[model samples]
Target: MDEPARRGRLPLPHRGIAFGGDYNPEQWPRETWAQDARLMREAGVDLVAVNVFGWAEIERSPGVYSFEELDSVMDLLHEHGIAVNLGTGTSTPPPWLTTAHPEVLPVTREGETVSPGGRQAWCPSSPVVREHALRLVRATAERYGDHPALALWHVSNELGCHNALCYCDESASAFRRWLERRYGTADALNAAWGTSFWSQRYGSFDEVLPPRLTASAENPTQLLDFRRFSSDELLEWYRAEAQVLRASTTTPVTTNFMVTAHIDTQDYWSWAPDMDVVANDHYLDHRLDDPWAELAFAADATRGLAGGAPWMLMEASHGAVNWQPRNLAKAPGELERMVLTHVARGADAVCFFQWRASRAGAERFHSALLPHAGTDSEQWRATLRLGALLDALDEVVGTRPTSDVAVVFDWQAWWAVDAGGHPTQDVRYLDEVHAMHAALRRAGVGVDVVSPDTDLSGYRLVVVPTLYLVSDEAARSVERFVVGGGHLLVTYFSGIVDENDHVRLGGYPGAFREVLGARSDEFFPLDDGESVALDDGGVGRVWTERLEPRGATVRARFTDGPVAGGAAVTRHEHGRGAAWYVATRLGTGGRDALVTDVLEGAGVRPVLPGAGGDVDVVRRDGDAGSYLFVVNHGDDAFVARAPGVDLVTGRRADAHEVPAGGVAVVREQPTGRRRPSEEAPA
Candidate 1:
């Protein structure tokens, strides 16, 4: 168990599953508050997040505060037995404050001042903005310190969602200070940033600035460091507010983290430690042809971010989100399936972006638990149905799930691999990461998308999917994990760069070359719709490499490409375990074949063997017992072969039978009592 779990659980005042979302009573009239609360109770909601974007309503002017409106909402929720995840309301500053001090606003890279119409316009590095935000946080903590309804202290909503990279003078000064602290001297900074080229050497820290428009593209190292500094600056603001809130009350502090690959500004790996409860806000990609797969991948990634402990799905959509390019409502049963997916992975609490829909605002069209169509709508009914389902799955709380396979997804790699000047602009980090994760899901193999720094003691197989930035520490960790008898799969474009975005000299696959038992001479980036034949009757595309195996057995070789007859894949025995290197992007069939061979070699089996065709299965172990969550995402019926009582139906079945778009939660027998043949049915 993690420290948080070992100590105690959070989202307090209620046990079981937490089922409510952001409640903006400020948007509705005084009379509507009671109706919302009553409806929340009817829907089995025990928690409601409040005061998130209420800075304008709470504090009118400098140091002038009014909590009359907020007090009424809190009292009403308390009267209705709903706990509150009290927010500090520091996401956006009031219009009066912005008008009084325009310096508080951020400046873009083009040096344009941000206006006050949007949320998160204030610069995190600005002293004035920090001071005002801290003031509001202090006031909020003081008012709700001992309130009956206060459950958790939500520190500033989504810290760097908008102003992650501000090029304002205030940010520039802060960045310089951060660089000075990181590098200690200008000469050190110059050397780290490779400033000798293009006559960019800095004589003093003040000479450095946030990466902005130059005559040409900015220096890659400088841009990388600037992003690091900006992320830290925002983190510093979160820590400051969190410190004040902690001093005022014993409530747990958390800020919603955007845990997706698209938002790369803030590295949540570094920020995850500061939060008492790891809370994430995930939105389905409407652009994706298969969003549920992405959701499953994201939930597993979020669970890994929480150190395999239970986390909170702080914000998700009940139906269509307003920000996607093409907003589409959830198909019948998608809402339930989405929520259940998170819970099956490791979410102890499930909450949405809002409870009631907005009438007039930027997010007025955003779907909520209570839509604009009123309580009679399908959305509201779905919310009620989900709430009842959660009420029955109370035994799932505090449980931890273990995965035999892990996909290494590092932020450093995500930042550095996609850095400008790569061999091909088509080098997408998430594409490769998701390919491995999606394959695992399709095969019914439970997978965990974890950071490179995470401990690999639990997993039997670790797949490094195009991790470009392999720090010496991370490299050694992987080596140790493999040497300790763990199976590892490394892909192309990996282990090429160091933490500073500097390529490791000597050969490609830098620090990992020794363990991988292979080295690359050059990159053969194929053109669009082009492919290379492999010796194993498979084809590789997008990228290929001139590989020479060293003290390893060649698994496959290129047949007809620039690197013809070269090693396309190699497997090497390193100590007690094995390391496999994939030198190119193998087609889907090739990847599936390769993954299946690796799983067989590693003695790993899927949660549901041969329960194919979009039937996703995962298991979680807890004090209650083991739980097998089998969900069918296909159009056909699936008969789960796992043996246990179906918790959703509260009945013992010989085999759980679920129809199309159905779910089954089975409580299995204890591990020791189970027969050997019944161990994760093969």
Candidate 2:
């Protein structure tokens, strides 16, 4: 809230959710702007994002600026009573600039320097690139500084573009400088990147190699360093615009991260701190249940980034996207429910990719508020319904839920696993992480998706999934939590590796093995359809391992199978507390059962009672306040048997069974007690 307020508004604005999508008047004729605005009003769209990729139009030639078109667009939107989120137009380098300043282009993993056309194609480390990029930003802000319609400043389209960059002399030199700023000298850099392994010793700062094809990522440390470097590279870019944008204009600045993204390769835990609010282009893969889980976790993670402040869904589909092999339409109440579900979690706004459908391009068939032939289509009706809901909710967008349980979502570990050469590639990090998180939500546990670096003392229970890399400091943090008599859950692959993607050098599940009360000597990576029987734990596929106990008790062992006596799950007593380890990849049911058992033991249950299925009910109950957000994920029409009156209508959610894809928002009355924070400020 401090950061958001500093940027000039409540996280989502106390008024309610923003209802608008990306609008590009530059793509069409001037005549079309009026029709688009009229249609936007009819669709209940209130906020419009513009100038996202108008580099060519904004800058017709070098040193010659043309923002007249943009000025008119912003003014008209303001006249229409729509809030504007003006972008910096730096995502793509203008064709003229790219043709002249070829060095501004980025180097690919294959060591090929690109020639522009694509977005985020500029080398982040290139001074020339930064100069021109920041110039555009300062120019836009200076011109539109006092505009009332100007609400937020979208820095660049997607900071996530293909490949790690700056393999050129400029980047190499910049990389050296970056290293100097991070680690003091060549020796520190050597240790951090483990350069001694390949005899790749750097005699001087100039001798170091960029993490490109030329460097050859044969060493795991090299690859990981490149990952770190690339993330930092993106961070540098985000910080640049944020710094300049905040100088004169006090608009909230945000860049979109693609949630569960594999290609862009950024660690949000590291990047999120710089933002006023975290925004992501959250496009779901065709799989619906997985989408629901991902949305919940991602939204929670964004909110939890800064003391559970609401985040923005910078991009959503009005209907479907062209990229998915099978793009499916949103079901009856699905879109509206999905919108409300994000609100329930902690979302300030939800914006679609484009305001109107494209007549051409890769995204021509992509979903939009206005179909290819603009009208009040099913999607438009869906958008309207959500807007109507927000109208009814009356600005629940920026409200922060004071009560929450921290569920550690370690992206560092997630990245380490993805980079590490696992016994099998079939093991799904995204799926597994989501499954456990979904279970916690289903049990009505108000979750705070956090990282190992997050402060953990506030939470009664902390759950870590597939924690492959456990830094000594992070381990001690967990130890402190357990020592303070807090509950802990560490699952398989929990502590098998270090930062270098190297195993702990002892038995499998090495360091966490003791914390988990067992050690695995062998790991089995099964085919997708294959299954290994779990005694009380449940059978699983993808990855399974056998454990040897040092201390702690075996909770579940494989039953009636080849590894009948092997450990599947274990519990250990460490420093006046308990730690649970789930050692296998269970299907949804089995995973839920394991997680639910742990939650029940801790006596920290979901707000909703008894066997809930796909519906994820999370309650934020505390002295400050209590909020119950219920989400239904199953395809079939499902009713959430939640206990509480709907805060919006004051009607009991139990009176009428909610429709499938439906959600209920219940604000519970807090008892006569004050929060710890109320007693003492953090």
Superposing all C-alpha atoms, what RMSD in Å does each candidate have to the true structure? 2.1, 3.7
Clashing pairs in 2: 15-395, 16-395, 443-606, 444-606, 444-617, 467-494, 519-547, 519-548, 520-547, 535-559
Tens digit per residue, CA lDDT, model 1, 1-682: 1365423455467889899999998888888988898999999998888999999999988899999999998988999999999999999999998999999899998889989898998998989988888998898889989999998988888888889999989888999999989999999998888899899999999888888877797899988888888889988998999899889787788889888756878887888878788889998887876677788888998887777777899999999999888899998878877888899999989999889999999999999999999988888889888998899888888776777899998766777767678898787888888888887788777888888888887777899999998789989999998898888999999999888888899898888998988888888899888899999988998999888889779999999988999999899999888999998888888998998888877768877667644888888876667888888888988888777788888878768887889888888866553321235334
Candidate 2 lDDT over 1-682, as tens digits, reads 2554633324432266777889988878999998887777776677888999888898888767898988888888877788887898888888787788887787765777787655667777778878888998888889998788888888887775563445776777777776778778888777766677768877767776666664344666666666677788878888999898889877778888776534437877788778877777776666555676677777777676655765777888867788777898777767766676666766667788889888866688898877765454666666666667666664354456543357777666766677645777776566667777787777666678888877788766788887777786777788788777667887777777677666677787776655666777788667667888876646776777767767878877777444668777778888877788877787777887877777656556455554256766655443345566666666655455555566545686444355566766665544543332233322
Best candidate according to TM-score: 1
RMSD of 1: 2.1
Largest lDDT belongs to which candidate? Answer: 1
In model 2, the runs with Cα more than 4 Å from the true position are 1-14, 163-169, 214-217, 261-264, 287-289, 402-404, 500-508, 521-530, 559-564, 619-627, 635-654, 667-682
Model 1 alpha-carbon drift over 4 Å, by segment: 1-8, 671-682
Model 1 TM-score relative to the real fold: 0.97
